[model samples]
Target: MDLFGCMNVKGRSGTKSQSVKFFILGEEFNDDAKKVEVYKKSIDLIKHGSPRGVITPIFVTYCSRFSRMIVCYPYFDESLSDWLKRYKGGSSNLPYEIRIMIRNLLAAIEHQDINRLEDISPIVCVKSKRDNTMEVKVILLPVQSEQSSKAKWRTSFSSLLRKNMHQTWLEDKDFEAFLLMLESNEYTLENLMGHPVLQDGDSNGRLILDCFRETLTPAQHKELEEKLNVQKYDGGDWRLRLQGKTPLENMSKRSTAYPGHDFLWFARKTVAHFNENDAKFKNATVNRVPAANVIKDLYPGFISDLYKLSLEPQYLNRALG
Candidate 1:
């Protein structure tokens, strides 16, 4: 079972949702006993039910079929992607100050590590949104080698943890990045003008490298940033101004985000239990959430269900193994 898509979510009890729609689903490829075991293991991994929903793995369910897991996501007005396209990608382009604003927003994510601060990978897919710009969420999707019906995208931790677990986790890498992002003091890319977001219209990505050399620490900037500036990938258009390797692609301008779907990877990691648990099957990963929280919107219950199914460790382990 896998996430089908998002839907119109409604109502919640206090902070709890009344009817949350999750798209993650389950499938019939493995033994029932094995499936149950993996499901239980993952549930044990999750300790807290995120309050602010910042670095927490949201686990509310909307109801799903036997084949998959169900989740409930909030419905926001728009996505960060669309917002960027409209506000930044459009003719207006992003102002240097605005870029700082956005970069600051993304930088904030580096600090929060949900599990292990050192272990947290980059936040995955991002989308555009409306309403409150500050509300924009940097979606963290799962990283996986294969796709399946049980949690088409991936599964949920809430489902796994809900069953039974004695231990409790106070902080994780996701929370680490979340805190860093939230507490970021280095707003400047080089302290000169921040990370050189507003590039010359004719320039490639490399120019940013020089800026980083002056601004960011050796660790803050990635090798890809420099390499990409000099090279072009399958989908990248060197001629046209780039937007830091399409939201989904990895280090390549030409490739699409996450290769499968824009937000799929983000959904997978943040919500996926099996994928994250399996070190062997690494999910497509990005560096971190954009300072702007790029993507924001309610994920459909169908998609939530898929995540539940995907989180089932036994099924996913078999697939990955």
Candidate 2:
């Protein structure tokens, strides 16, 4: 099918810092040539040069020798930022269409992860030319290549994770479980946090964690193998594709199984920590609005920590005993 898009050029664009210009073949395009090449290679590497379980946007280079480049996608009625601003609660309770876009985007990411390809672009939402539909499209843009070392990339990854408050849905226990899953990949719980506990002052340790985080497990590693295969990429609903595919439920079970524990003991500790912090703020002489604001700010981190603790059997066993 011939994919088409408009040239009206409406709405806000990404910042200059987040964008780059590229020279493809002999023509200039406003993107990175390397990213375009990588994306082209990814397309060729997939099952049929067109992956299923996701709708990848078509990139049209307007020349035999890649002289010009334009990403052909349907016109999106709203940017994710604008949509989130209008919708109040962000991705937590996104409208159906937007949710589909985000899900598809993540599915694309999963495809890249599954293929073990690096330097792929995150998906963007756009209005489709095919029946004016809103869809997620992956645009190949150059990522900053200055982070040449594993440590540098790991630091960047953790910092990004910490800033994305929406990831609170993972919960602290789930976060830790996910970490454990990644352990076979050589990542530790600390690799995902900006300022991991205890080892805060050790740059060398952070570097080591970063290097570990990028290490991929052998394909023969069964446990890690299963989690990485969570979605089958059969071109179905992204949510359905992820349902029960991984052993996420197993993690939840392990998290709640501390000796003589009914409820997850570590989960309770996280709640206590939040309450304690809130109490401290309330008792302070600060204005009620600011105090409340502070609690709100701190609450998500506590939740994240609580989720992380779920993966720590040693800590749970020690504390519950």
Candidate 3:
């Protein structure tokens, strides 16, 4: 029989653990002997499989009363869904959080492909730990009787990305391109890992803000300091400018003290040069401008440019030799 549910368990060491939540394969078998056989095969596959980013079951037992297999895994701090919910309004670590998720998820999928564990749905079982550093855990569930094909797994993975990720961290173009490649089914796992979007570097908006600050004229800097009361442009200020909003207007004291109309005009003009040339700037007059919300959306080509810059001989020699 194909069935799945969640249950809390107590470990031998006295720590509480969670049972693996199974993904139903829509296959049903009435025979007890056949169910036992399927359970054994699933256990063996997990026992021998060495899949990075996949959690190995700590214990497995056949319950005669329930006529079901109980698979318990080590305690996970939280599910991926819960973790993402905490940051729905957005956070500074969102880029790092997303990058870690993508890396582990891809690794788990690669492992599944290698071990022929296509029936194991890692995407459904994603978890995370937040002790010292953020980490993603892909809990591998028990194998199903009628295993899902590799194509099915790919389609499922792609659908999950499209559903959950498009509105979040990644830029639209980057995410769409990656999704296209994923759905293509031609690229190897290694090739996908090497893709520019997957490659890690820096996503710090402060760096880009500093670059913008450098382009500011001496008079413009003075105006920003005196009128807007902005000494240095931080990430928050940069974000407001990107959204075609003024930082001074958002602050209670500044909003009251400064002339709202005049300050907003000055602020817009101050950032006009950078916004027009370097960043994606929306018109403040527009009722709803679909602008880049996260730092990942700003300068989508910057990360790739940084990668190319690193490959240059001057940078390579300085860093390596």
lDDT of each: 0.30, 0.34, 0.46
Tell me the tens digit of each residue's lDDT in model 1 across 170-237.
12222222223223443222222222222221121222112223233333234323322222222343
- For residue 118, what is the lDDT in candidate 1? 21
TM-score between candidate 2 and the true structure: 0.34
lDDT of 2 by residue, 255-285 (tens): 4444332122322332233334565533432
Where is the poorest 10-residue window by lDDT in model 3? 285-294
The list of candidate 1 runs beyond 4 A from truth reads: 1-21, 25-56, 60-66, 82-134, 141-321
- Cα lDDT of candidate 1 equals 0.30
Report the lDDT tens digits of candidate 3 across residue range 66-123.
5555555655556666565565545222355565556666776654642332323343
What is the number of backbone collisions in each predicted candidate, taken in the order shown? Answer: 116, 12, 0
Ranking by lDDT: 3, 2, 1
TM-score to true structure, per model = 0.29, 0.34, 0.51
